[model samples]
Every structure is written in structure tokens, then in C-alpha cells.
Target: MISALTAPAPRAGNRAPRPIYVTKGGDMLNPFTPTPTDPPSYLAKYTARDTAPGLARRDAVRTLLSWGLEQLADAAELVVSELVTNVLSHTSTRTINVTLIRTGETTARIVVMDTDRTEIVLPACPGDDEEAGRGLRLVASMAVQWGVERVVTGKLIWCDLQEDR
Candidate 1:
């Protein structure tokens, strides 16, 4: 698994940090308040064909931060890129959907849906001479928790992130 590097909290003298909410598709049902029944704070939807240029993933993460999820922006973006790349490389589907949700004041979730239902396995980290095989490892390291769920038409791979409240 790829290890996550945590930067120390900002020094006390710095101004208070701004709220960060990074989402990909869907709308932010609650921008300021966190409620029990409310949906995720940010959402993103895409199709298999949407994975062509990697910038889409970056834009999606930026949108979430703009909507108020700055803390999760970087990790979410990395996860999105790795997951989406896997979908494009392994599945025959032409579209996929990605969503980012703030489940609690200190937790966020990243979900990727694809028409393919095959299980994903992370390949062993290769030597410096190898060109690939490290995506899922990165996901395992960065996410606090993660797994896959089978759906009627496809599957969803999701991960959880614990944030600093």
C-alpha cells in the first residue's frame, strides 16, 4: 500500500483554516450544515468515455473543494485518478460515475461506479524497471477504509477518509 504523508497542522499563529469540501459529481444538498439524513456534501458523475483526458478527474476534485471540501481534495483526486484509470484499463464499459460525499464532520467517502462487475486486485509493487502496478496500493494507503459493492447493473468501489475536524 502507498503510504499517506500527513503535513503537520498549521502553526497556531496562522489564520484559522477555511472549510474544505471536495466533491466530484451530483449536487451539495447541504453546504453548511451536517445532518443525519442528508446526502453527501459533494457528488460527481461520469461515464466510461469520460476518462480520456485526465484533467476531468482534476476538475472534479477542484469542484468539490470549491463547494467546500478542501481538506479532501488531494486524496480524493488521487483516488479518483487511480480508480478511473483501472476502470478504463480493465473494463469494457464506456462510462463510469464518481461521487465524493462528506459523511460526517470528520469523515468523507469516495465512490466510483462502473458497469463492470469484476473484482479489482492490486498488483504487487514492481521494481524500478517496471512501468506499472501500484494504483490500488496507493488507494489502500491513502484511504482510511475502502471496499467494493456489487449493484444490479454494475459495481461501486468506495473508500473512506477521516478528516480533521
Candidate 2:
């Protein structure tokens, strides 16, 4: 599981807040500020055999770091791992594709595409004692925006988050 406490925006005064940490093990990191004209960012695609959930997580973290979004690594890793894990656990597909696309200066979309075309059930809040069914909750909680998109071959689960400069 990943945990991030967003830094509250500063009050009426002109003080811009410190970098809102996308925290990892409670450590604060870089700030992401987006300007109107920044170009897109890209991270290399990673393909994983459907059975290898850990590989997906490891590579997701690596990709985020390689893309220079240290601020997003922790949350991105968890989100990618959960999405890939869901495919492995719930579908018969043999492979999965993970892509990180940055459409704006401080914004990125995490895409997890699998050959399974089945619709995904948005995760419902589980009780305190429930051990399962919290994966998407982690994603929805951390990401600013997230959704499922149907593709010609299969469905892609996507989420967008803020990234650092």
C-alpha cells in the first residue's frame, strides 16, 4: 500500500507552499510546477508476462525514476502494481503493457493495458477488516483523475497525477 498526505495550500497570503510531497516512507520530495507551454514527457513502455506482478512493480518504479519523476515513484509504483496485479489475478490474458504519458508540464497519465476486454468494477470501499478489494482505492485516493477506457483490443485503465519539473 502507498500513503501520501497532500500538503495543504497556504492561506490568503502570497506564500506558495513547499513542494507537496508525494511521500514515500514519510520523506518529502521535489515540487512540480506546470507552465502553460511545456512540452510532453515520456517514459519507456514496459511489457510483462501476466504472471509476473512483482516485475511490473519493479519496472514501474524504475520507469518513473527514469522519467525523472522521483516525486511520483512511490505512488506510481503502487498504482501500477495494483493495476497489473488485477489483470494477473482476474483475467486470462498473457501479457500487459504499462505506459507513462505526460501530457502537460506537471501532469502525467499512467496507462495499464491488457488484452482482457472485460469491464472493470470500480472498487468499492471495503470494511476495516476486509483484506481484499482496496487496490483501486489506493489509485483513486492518490491520483487526481482516473478512469477506464475501452480500446480496440482491450480496456485500458488510466490515471493522471502531478509530476515535478
| Predicted structure 2: lDDT | 0.66
lDDT of 2 at 7: 59
Query: How many Å off is the CA of 111 in candidate 2?
Result: 0.3
Q: Model 1, which residues run further than 4 Å from truth?
A: 1-37, 50-56, 119-128
Q: What is the C-alpha lDDT of each candidate?
A: 0.66, 0.66
Tell me each candidate's TM-score: 0.65, 0.65
Tell me how far the alpha carbon of residue 122 in candidate 1 is from the true structure, in angstroms, after superposition.
5.5
Alpha-carbon shift of residue 85 in model 1 (angstroms) = 0.8
Kindly list the per-residue Cα lDDT of model 1 for residues 1-165, writing each as its tens digit: 222344456788975444444343432222222222366544444555554326446655665565576777777778888888878877886567666677766567878788876665546769889888888878889889898878887887899976552
lDDT of 1: 0.66
Model 1 scores a TM of: 0.65
Model 1 lDDT, residue 23, Cα = 41
